[model samples]
Target: MYQYKNNILSIPARLLYQDWSLMSYDTYKKKCDRKQLIRTQQGKGLGNEAFLSYADLPHEIKSVCLDKIGRPEETVVINLLEPFIIPDSKASAFFSNHRTPEGRPLAEPKQRQKSINCWILNAVQLVFEDRGMTGKMFGKRKTRIWQNISEAVNKLDTNKWNHTLPGAAKRLKEKYENYLKEGYGIFIHKGEGNQNTAKIRGEVADFILSHYALPIKLTIPMVLAKYNLRRLEQNWPELAESGLYHWLYEPEQERIWTLARHGKQAWQNKFQHTLSRDKSNWFPNVYWAIDGTKLDWIHFDHTTGHKMASKLRINVLFDVYSEKIIGWSLSETEDHTDHFKAIKMAVKQAECRPYLLTYDNQSGHKMTRMQEFYNDLVALKGGCHHAHRAGAKNNPAEQLFNRFQQQVITKFWFSDGQGIRVKKEDHQPNTDFITAHKHHLKSKEELSPAWEMAVNQWNSGKHPHFEESRDEMYQHPMSLREQLSLQEIMQHLWVTESQKPITYKKEGLTLWLSHTQYQYEVYDGDGNIDIEFRRKYVGKKFIVRYDPDAMDVYIQLCELNAHQEKVFVAFAEPKRKHIDIPVLMQADDKMSWARDYAVRDIEYKRDKTAFEALIARSGYSPSAFIESQELNIKFKGSMPKKQQQKVDAEEDEVLLRM
Candidate 1:
């Protein structure tokens, strides 16, 4: 027996082997060789030649080798190579002599034989029995009972057993091959290990793809939920609280509301109501309403840098119903002359004589000269009725003034010289003034001039309001006058005059006479007719009337026809009252002696019988009930009859003589 320590073997069998010197020496030599082979096998250098040499060694050497190598290959090699020559006793001796240090016999050949027996047994068990001992049990039983167990142990090991002991080794080899083929049977295990990780990774990928990989068609709520969840997950509480979440929900509507609240209110108060034609109520040639307004007044001189100093007033007249401007004047001063010019323009522009001219109680409109003109017009039956009324309620023209101020005048600031108050002595240009002009030009001259130009351009140019020029709005004066025929224009020139009743005192015959200073004398059959006439006032009225043609007065009834024939008879004045005759006449025909003639007459006669009767009745003599008459009969030509006819010879001679 031997106990191995480190790389050396120790033996207690020296006394038992004292008489076997040669065997002991051979055993020592074989043991040294086996130790060499064991060293070689353990170091990964073993080969078939080393196994054969180990099996052929002597019993004593094999024992020594077994003790030295701690493995039994030499004895098996001896049994295989020299089986016929070696007796069973020597082989048995060889196997018994070999023992491990534990006192068990080192039976290298018998161990090999026993391992073969066990392998054979396991094979028989697998072949004959319903269930065989498992390959693991076979490996354990072979390792416990086998001698020189390297080959038998290798046959039972699945990897080494594949080469020997065909049936059991092949089955064991197949089992291990299938285990490797199924990836170490680890499919379900790997899946179980990674399941939670894959799920979390998939969710993260879905979030990233949803945000960045697709078009943004989601509603605001969806977007909010997505971002909120993400932010919550990301621990960004502050980001989640930003009102940007709500703002993105209604972006367009909120933007529009913001603009409406903050934008300019420039065009809010434009004119709302338009004048309707039905509201106009025009009287028939009676009322003449006149008014004027100042359009834009600037403190600065609009023409030159010279301060206009005074505001320019533009006077305009509205014909109320016509809505036409009858007169207009642009002037710096708001004096009576301005008023007079406006009125004169209106009068000349009126299509018919106005009955009453209504005007506001302006001081400039109440001039004495204007009043005198009104009285003269009344005297001429021109229907001069002047009414000075308050401007508050009755003035439609004042509304127009307000419109002008609101719409046009107040839109611009005037550069009128009223800038900064300075002493008159400092008014002259100096270095400071020059500096002001250079530096403060925007305040000084820019806006006023631009405003003036804009207004002028608006008036003269096409207007958006009327869609016409200011000049075109009221017809051009020349064109309007030219549109009327010559006769119609001449008719417009006729002046009206009224007649008062008058009585004459000559010869105690109460007569109505017209007084006249002599301008022309007509020769009647009784020589030059006197053209002088005297007027006498008989009650509240003139007692005489004048002859328009003879330029003298006769009894009111002693006027005549074209042939020196009497036309009217002198009448006696009534004791109770003197009667007055109503006269409406034109002054144009009496213009030659207009200043000298006290009255003018006009007659509309359509027939010769009326003319002849007036001529014959004019020759009556005056009595106390009537009156004496100094009559002058000078005939003015008569209007041509529309239908001329020739009478018979007798009638023709009477007409010619008459």
Candidate 2:
């Protein structure tokens, strides 16, 4: 507590020190050594005799004290005459307990503080005016009071409050007059609803928005300049360019502006609402989605030293369930061949058949040959196929391709990348660096390894729907019914178009294929000929369909249906012949001979059993059949009656021989 007596303030030493240091009692004692303070008992000085001196204190400190208490000289005089009273709150306090006439606290503390400061300066002016201080004296008094207040306000936290200098007396007076007229309501921030006060409004704002929101996307300054020319003709005030800019960029208007400036496709790709799909229940290899995208990388041929601009497209086949890239093929253009190669790779990599294959309806995918190939795949693998419309997002490969491009392709520095719907001119690669490093550019063949590495990395990552890596998820076993051997899948990958009919002979079927004569024997996964196939199609002309890459095995003897579709008949192996000389026979020849003899014995026994069974069923003995055949059953038309009767008698004898 502070006390005034004998023209000296009898302030407690701790109280004075506490106020000066703005610290707790115990902290003041420990950190500042309160016993060493002036007028302390330990110093042998007059204790608690600290008197106030306004001139001795800094200007900022004086101003702050005046706002908190009152003018220094009068405050001291009042303290001496009557007990001093503290203000409801300190000037340095941020949150004021005072409420406005509207029963709401001031919306902005800075605004309230600014109004209070102006009021203080106005009070100083009134005092001078009441005393008849005019001209220089009045000006000096007003300046002095404001300077004191501002200096003290500077000591306080000025961040939240405006630190307006004391020289702006005219502005301060105007603010004080507004406060008197409007009361505390004037301190309420203008941001609450005062944006209606913006200069660009009505027809001018509509004109600017309409012009700016055009697909041309006219600049704000350009629109403003045009509007100003119109205003000059109409004798209306021209709006400032910055004012129009601020209004146009407001949150309420920006969305409409952007949507109109850009097109619907851009809006849909970038800002449209999306629904997430849950694929956790899906099985690997049951559903495959394929799509093609132009790679971001720049490729050029080293031999020709010319860039192959926009010549590369990567067709990717991925398991939609596991999110694993099973296959991908790179080509100079989007063609049916690339799609076929990609499908082939996926089949070989997964070694399984898919139940449903989804692809985009690109021109390459709609080719008659491609359609037939897809039909063949479905027929062999037992699945349906679907082709989505252009720009349809139903294909998972589209999303997977985007992820691969952004996450994997962007890591390569030379990759020329851009966001979706971004103009190429807005985001282009460093052409100068590319030109300087032209020698380092890779050809299509060289770029393949990089693509392979990226695929591997993508497969190695954890799947979003599973707790395992994509490769692990893809490796999980699927139904055996949907599985196929690599050879079986490859057999259907090649087109089954017949070159020419070939005869099925006693040894094998022979055809002139790929500029060479080749013999393929009916294998049926075992020996040259099974009993049923030999009996049904022996000596018949058939078409041979086989994959060139796997010509050693997987030859198919097929028959063409009414629709020109290949109907599989039997699988065959390349015919192998062996020399009969025992001394000259190699190990392979001996093995081949052993297999042939074993298979032939089985076939002979089967045929013999079938022959005997047929004879028994017919109730015919072999001796009886021979005796019956000895009698003549045929007679000439001009033969005598006795001869005819003999012929009839011989027929009866043959019939009765059973």
How close is every model to the real structure, measured as TM-score?
0.22, 0.35
What clash count goes with each model?
A: 30, 2
Reference-based lDDT, each prediction: 0.36, 0.59
| lDDT tens digits by residue: candidate 1, 81-190 | 11111122433344356433223563464444433323333343342233232322222354332222223334233432222332444443453344346521211222
List, residue by residue over 1-658, the lDDT tens digit for candidate 2: 3333223323344433455554465654554344333231222376523443334334564565566556544533211111111222333243255443223454465545555454453444444454443322222455454443333333333443343534444444565567568654454454342232265665555556655665656787777665665576556554555456656665334434555567445433432322222233343538888888888887785455575444567888998888998877786666665787788888887766788888998877866656777876663546788798767767788888877776778677667765445666535566677678877878778888988898898999888788999999987876644566767775568754343667665456766643556667765555544545654455566777655445676577888775667678888777666556676667986786776656544544554454344344433334443454454433325568897666544532353455
- Candidate 1 global TM-score: 0.22
Top TM-score model: 2
Mark the regions of model 2 whose C-alpha exceeds 4 Å error after superposition. Answer: 1-285, 302-310, 376-382, 418-421, 424-427, 465-467, 476-481, 498-658
